[model samples]
Target: MQKSPLTSTGEALLRGQLQTLKTSERQRLRHVLEEARAHGDLKENAEYHAAKEEQGLLEAKISYIESQLQSCTVIDTSKLNTDKAVFGAIVTLENIETEDKSTYQFVGEAETDMEQNKISYRSPVAQACIGQEVGDTVSVDTPSGQIEYEIMDIRYS
Candidate 1:
């Protein structure tokens, strides 16, 4: 499988979620299933059916998270160069048409939170900004139209 790039923080968060599923959630679900099984008929027990369904979903989540952890490459942002926009760089941009400024931290898909100004590296804006330096203008095609942005600064933390 192709490796997915993830910031170290993103990797840690995923790992923590996996740990919780393996340790606490699995045990809790198992207990719930056992309790439901005790109070029922095999075919008509609503509690038993719900518990079984929940267990299936939980197991699937655990499997998915494990797969992601196995296939991810953790990137340490501090070691990256700050001279150009790259994965894990905090890039400041100015909208060329509207002159509005915005700052975004480029991260992996799992860590992207638009409300926090974190964007995935695969996003159109990040794709356009990657490998670009300050004063460089990048144009990205959007559903509405092509938008232009001027890179103002790049920093790594």
Candidate 2:
């Protein structure tokens, strides 16, 4: 499996999620399944069916997360040079068309959250920003259209 680059924070978050799933979630789901099974017949019991479905989903998620963890490579941003944009770099950019400035922290796919301004390195914006330094202009093809941005700052954290 190809390893994916993950920031320290991203790796920590993934580890936290894995721990929660292994301990709290797994135990809770098992208890729920037990209760559901005790209720009635498996074929027609709504609660039993729901719990079984939930178990399947939870197991799938656990497997996927485990696979990602197995292929993850935690990247320490502190030791990396800040001269250019790279994985784990927090980049500030100005949209050339709107003159609106925004900041984004490039992170692993598992940790990408748009609300937090964290984008996956494989995302269009992050791809454009990669290897770019301050004052460099890059164009990203978005669903809305092609947009251009000027790199304003790059920080490790």
How many pairs collide in each candidate, listed in order?
0, 0
How far off is model 2, as Cα RMSD? Answer: 1.5
Superposition error at 89 for model 1 (Å):
0.9
**lDDT of model 2, residue 113:** 97
TM-scores for all candidates?
Answer: 0.90, 0.91
Q: 49-143 in candidate 2: lDDT tens per residue?
A: 88888888888888988888889888888889769999999999999999999999989998899999999999999999999999999999988
Q: Write the per-residue lDDT of candidate 1 for residues 90-144, one digit (tens) a residue.
A: 9999999999999999998877899989999999999999999999999989999
Runs in model 2 deviating more than 4 A are none
Cα distance off (Å), candidate 2, residue 78: 2.2
Number of residue pairs clashing in candidate 2, backbone atoms closer than 3 angstroms, sequence gap of 3 or more or interchain: 0
Question: In model 2, which residue pairs have backbone atoms overlapping below 3 Å?
Answer: none
- In angstroms, the error of model 2 at 33 is 1.9
**CA lDDT of each prediction against the hidden true structure:** 0.92, 0.90
